[model samples]
Target: MAELLRNYVAGKWIAGNGEGTLLTDPVTGEALARVSSDGLDLRAAFDYTRTSGGAALRGFTYAARAAQLSEVAKLLQAQRDDYYAISLANSGTTKNDSAVDIDGGIFTLSYYAKLGATLGDVHALRDGTPANLSRDQSFTSQHVLTPTRGLALFINAFNFPSWGLWEKAAPALLSGVPVIVKPATATAWLAQRMVADVVNAGILPAGALSVICGSSAGLLDQIETFDVVSFTGSAKTAAKLRAHPAFVARGARLNVEADSLNSAVLAADAEPGTAAFDLFIKEVVREMTVKSGQKCTAIRRAFVPKDHLGAAADALVARLSAVSVGNPRNESVRMGSLVSREQYDAVRAGIASLREEARLAFDGSQVRLVDADPAVAACIAPHLFVIDDASHAVRVHDVEVFGPVATLCGYEVATGNSRLEEAQAVELARRGQGSLVASVYSNDDTRLARIALELADTHGRVHAISPSVAQSHTGHGNVMPMSLHGGPGRAGGGEELGGLRALNFYHRRAAIQGPAASIDALTESTGKVEI
Candidate 1:
């Protein structure tokens, strides 16, 4: 029998009441573990963390909490090889893909550690300059931000269990808030192991970090008005959470990063042989194949000039054909399976729906695997579709396949003007309702600037690639810690991970109105404030 994973809650490791959900390897269909939280006391867990854990964490200043984060990062770095192995078995990820989650998590923790040091010993931060409230200037209003007197509950996706946990935990911990993580059940092994390691190391206070690795049945019921919930998954799930009684009636804060059909555009001025055009092809292929194109920010829509649609399709197909897909254990395989069979079926279904309007430019369904069975393994070949007329394609814009699939769409150029083409591309991208990111490839500085500005309101980040920055630019799907990572509208209308900006979500801002001397004393004090 495979080991049953245990939930870490209320300073103890406990098993659920009955037979739990079985977790299997996507590539080989091997049973890995079982997980459940059927009988756990969630109300007690929340109360303990909020009162005991929250108080202990809030007792430390920002710099002291940052030191603890650095130690946690170091401990994870020392054992990352084990994490890589777990990721391969649980997530069906190649070595490179594992690095993106494991290493990315460690790096985010370290980045926040260094950033938090600059905050010094302050517990509450000054929001802005004080304003005079009275005519004599004797009274003033001073805005300040302090940590919420509650815990942070994280509901993460299966694609990135490790990074998803730490990316939110780093800021919440730095801001003196405890964290309760509930990783997706399909790939919860890595997240459970990481929490066990940190808890055993005693780097954090008891109940400071916890993981519940099964059904999220009663987790939201324990939340109060001061608590925060962060979720990353499908937009359908996000809507349900928004309408949950905890958020609607109790006023608990919720931040969501949901489904996004991010796009990439090739400039009209760049022909087939130009450097800008080549760069655009490379970026789109990288985004589609990376993590089997499971990233929320992956480019699902590729827009090019209508005149060069054939050339773009040929280049993309050629590049995608060279990619090898199978089990990640095989060194020759460039891509691996989806997180589960359910996701594989969903991706195939999404592709079928897109075919109603777009032509199948490249069919990878018959590609040979390196070392896995095509019938049993969840591996899928990279697929490319071409929509000659993007204006009529509804499913292509609205649907996200969430796998190694991309649609190559063409934007019309009726006026023979580059400016008009750029506008058309932006309009097509906006049809997705909203997105996490969009990249524009152009050597022309004026065109790149115009499109980027227009895309700002819809996308959280805009990546502009030219020959000048091609060598140094991060890939379009790569979410950096220094930049924002969420978008508006269909992308979930939330913000996260822009250096210090992430801490804002975990804190509560209040304006203190009092005498000028009293306000000055509040700002000058370096002591921790008891909640």
Candidate 2:
């Protein structure tokens, strides 16, 4: 029997009353650990956060809070082996992927630590101009980013569990806010281990962080105006939460990075013989196999010119078919299992629905498995759908498969037609719009620039990939610590950037204008006022 992992709340380890849930190795299906919160009380957890944790965290200056983050980063670095051990229970990660998820999260903290130190000190005061008869300057005022007087709630996804928790936690903590983390049940054990090490290291204040192992019942109702709710999961759940009366009526900040129907386009100019063709094929396979295609940013839509549909689909299938799946610990296995059987079924169902407007280009469903207890391993080989849309069903466009599955949507792209599809997708994405990001490719310099510019207008950020960046992990999973990560329409219009911007999501930003003298006085500027 593996050890049972517990929750970390109010600075100590506490077991909960709920019976322990088993977590097994994705490869061997052997029990790795049992996670539970048998004695943990959600109400007490919230109370501890609101009263003690929130107050203690707020007591620190932003800089001080950042210092805590820096210390915690070092502590986590030392305990990464412990994190890795827990991580193996949920397959689909290589050493490389694990390093990015775990170390990458700590690096985000380090980045923000430098950001907080370099930004400014508290209330040395900003300068504004004098106003009123030479007494004050015009349009001069001081601006200081202040911490919101509320708590932060993070409802995370199972894939990249550690990254999902810390990437959100780091900035919120650095911003002088307390955090309540609820990890997905499938991989919550890994998060439990990581947080336990941090709390034990004593880097965070007693009330700085709290963890909940199960449901987040009744927690949202308690949130105040300045409190933040950041969620990383399905769009459907985000939509339901965004409509919560308290979020709308009280103006609470809700930032969601839900899964989107993200895409990658092949440039029309690239002939079948060119480097771009090979690049396009490689990208599709990589996105499909990485983390067993369990990423929000993974390329779900592959858009190519209608003329090249056969070639693109065949090449993609051939590449995907070659992928080896088994235990991630096996050096030969190129891909691993989905986080759970529930996820496998969801992806399978989505692929079934796609057949209404698409056909199977290649199927890996019959691929061999090495797991002794294959059912318990919860593994599903990658699946591909070739979509030829005669009539677009809302399900095909809106619902995400959430595993090693995706669709290739062919489009006719004359200069005139390209303009129409981009426009249509954006409009559709906005109303029921959903996507985290989109990329467009074209070999013709003018056409590429045109496609890139047009897509940029609609997507959060557009990547114009050529032969060079095909394998770059530059912006793969969560948003880079500095950039915004959210979609405009059905993708849920919430945002989560890594540093000060992420911090601001937890707080409110207000613009106050008045006479320069009064503004300067109000702002409490110390040096010669800039305004």
Candidate 3:
């Protein structure tokens, strides 16, 4: 029997009442742990966060909260080796992949800490120039960002157990809002250990951070009007969460980052064998197999000109062929298995559905494993499918396989009778309804400007790759804390990160109408003392 993982509720590390759901390793199919939040009191958790946790954080200035984050990061980083070992055994990611989550998570804390420290000892951040309420400028109004006097409820996805928690938690904690993290049950142990590390370190105040490793039963019902909920998962779950009575009736804010069909385009002028075409292929292959293509921001669609479509397909297929899949512990393994057999089955079903409109350029679901049992391992090969008809293949655009799968759409360079415009690229990219990010590879400045401007309304981030930025360019699937992440329509119409802008989600904006001299007490800057 595996150890039963405990949930940290209201400053207590407590176990569930009944037998819990078993968590197994993807590679070895061995029982690693059991997780449950059964019989936990949701009301106490909520009340503790509001009273004990919120009270501790609310008294601190922004700079003090930032200092806490820096300490927390140090504590987490010091124990990274232990976390990586757990990830290697259970999280179904390779060594480097685990670092991307564990190390990347600490980096988020550091990044936000630095951002917060620059604000000095301010309690509220002023918006813009104060508005003169009266003709003589005796009275004025100033908008400021203050911490929300409520808790943060986070529902994270399974793919990123650690990064998902910290990315949202860092901003909320820095802004003085306590956090309640509910990680997916499938990989709850990884998340549990991370919270346990912070709790054991004793850096954060009691009740400032808590983790519920099982079902969030009745928790959503406990949300108040002022609280914030940040969720990452499927669209179906997002819908159900949106309609929760507490959320709908009380006007609680919900932010979602759903898995949409993100697309990447190869420019028309960047023909076969060129650097642009080569970069597009390399990036597509990397995105398709990394974390076994479970990322919400992974490139699902690749648009190429009709003439170069064959060459692009051949290149991608060749790259996919060279990838080694099996147990991640194997020294030679280039790619690892899906998170579980259930995920493997889902990917198989998605690939079957995709085969209706697109033929497999490289099908490796039946490929032999390098260092693991094919029958027992959750190993599935990377697949590349191509749709010859780009304009009308709605299935490729609408449906996301959510695994190591991508569809190649052959698009036309000419629109109707004209051929010089770059609208064709944007048209093909927009078929995703809305996407988190789109990568456009072009050497021509005019085409880059044209496609980027056209796609701006649809995508949250448009990554235009030229030779200049390509060398140091972060790939298509990654998100930076300094950049704005989130998209319109199907991708979830909520923005999450944009330097200090992400802090706004955890903060409340107020317009105070008063004399400038009196407002100086609230804002950091000197406001008309002479008046």
Candidate 4:
């Protein structure tokens, strides 16, 4: 039996005649499905959105749109199992990881739905007794958010198909705009499957949602003003996309969440056998192996006291080695394979480059795994690198090994304000290497607060983990609806908050001043002309 992949456009299921693109099971390397993007109506899809679908979406109020999103969330929750089965083929992730990506996406939709209903204004004006000039005078202001006229183009990474698509789409929908999702070729079948479900539900208006499974096909060149384009991939690709003629000219709200050298720093007070040490080891290993370390927010660097570096590295390797790797269907398998052979090769190349500034503390190449089909299996074990020169440009920061690999950097601090003291602290700060998220394990409130503020000005978000207050549900891979997700510099200075902030990106803000009644009427509807 062959898997059928369908594209949703103008609120209908449309099939194409393109040759099938193979979809393989990560662990066993067997064909799970085949997808194609040939014959897809790229131009027609855009036209339909701008003309028909965009009008329908814009016809609804923010509260009405939120109600629709809540309904879709319920529909998706019922189909959770179908999504899980398909998700297993891309990466043999455990049920928990899949839930975070799949159901979490649904939760994100629900969250934004509630925000849309409660956050926006309801009425026009009201009379008040206390006035600046007269007793009967009234003052009023309304915060009205309208959808941007152009479409929101989404360029998604392959790791979490469901989360990546929904995280971008939820806000666009809530803001009364249409979306065009472009999923990466390697793992797009999972996304295709989910979109099929959404289309079948028949809630979204025609042209309101569209999907392109293959090349962006000159879509980047067509973006116009008030449009938003978001990409989740490498910095190199992001730079290229940013340089697109349309993006440069229109400055269409481009949001790029690129891969970076994120890190976790352990304080000197955290020693072995304590909760902090255990948490450190768990965090490092989980980041290295989850989705085969394909996450953009995965920890790339581990910083520890010079004395604890060896112990921490060894503990990390030991934890990783015990994680069983095989088909996710097997209950014992804790880790899975990379999405494809090409991704595995790229990760391997990155690990090989670390020889310049770091040494392999524990080699994953020696680890054993069972692959039924070696030809199709793109499998590689986790690799660890221990950094010696914190200032080294290439290995310490420049390169990002997007796989089950990590580097451990150690630093020694001296008492008082000496040159060595400055060097040690500076080295840790530099070791961050343009990260998306940097975390510190410490119990000292004063030091934690200082570090949080210092890194906040530098990194996107700083996590100060202490025994007193920490949530298991929180991880580097997770992006909350309230906070900005992207980091500065190498991580791509763009964001996706999935809240009012993300919604605002799809619209523009302008202030008009005149008589209060005229301003209020103009703000509500443009149909009422002053003349």
Best by lDDT: 1
Candidate No. with top TM-score: 1
Q: Order of all candidates by TM-score, from best down to worst?
A: 1, 3, 4, 2
lDDT of 3 by residue, 216-238 (tens): 77889889988999999988889
Off by over 4 Å in 3: 415-420, 524-531
**Could you tell me which residue pairs clash in candidate 3?**
none
What are the root-mean-square deviations of the candidates from the true structure over C-alphas?
Answer: 2.1, 3.6, 2.5, 4.6
- How badly does each model clash, as a count of residue pairs? 0, 20, 0, 1
Better of 1 and 4 by TM-score: 1
- Cα displacement (Å) at residue 102, model 4: 1.0
Model 2 clash count equals: 20
lDDT of 2 by residue, 262-330 (tens): 877777676677877777677778788887888877877777777788888888878887888777777
Instruction: State the displacement of the C-alpha of residue 401, model 3, in Å, after optimal TM-score superposition.
Output: 0.8
- What clash pairs does model 1 have? none
Worst-scoring 10-residue span by lDDT in model 3: 522-531
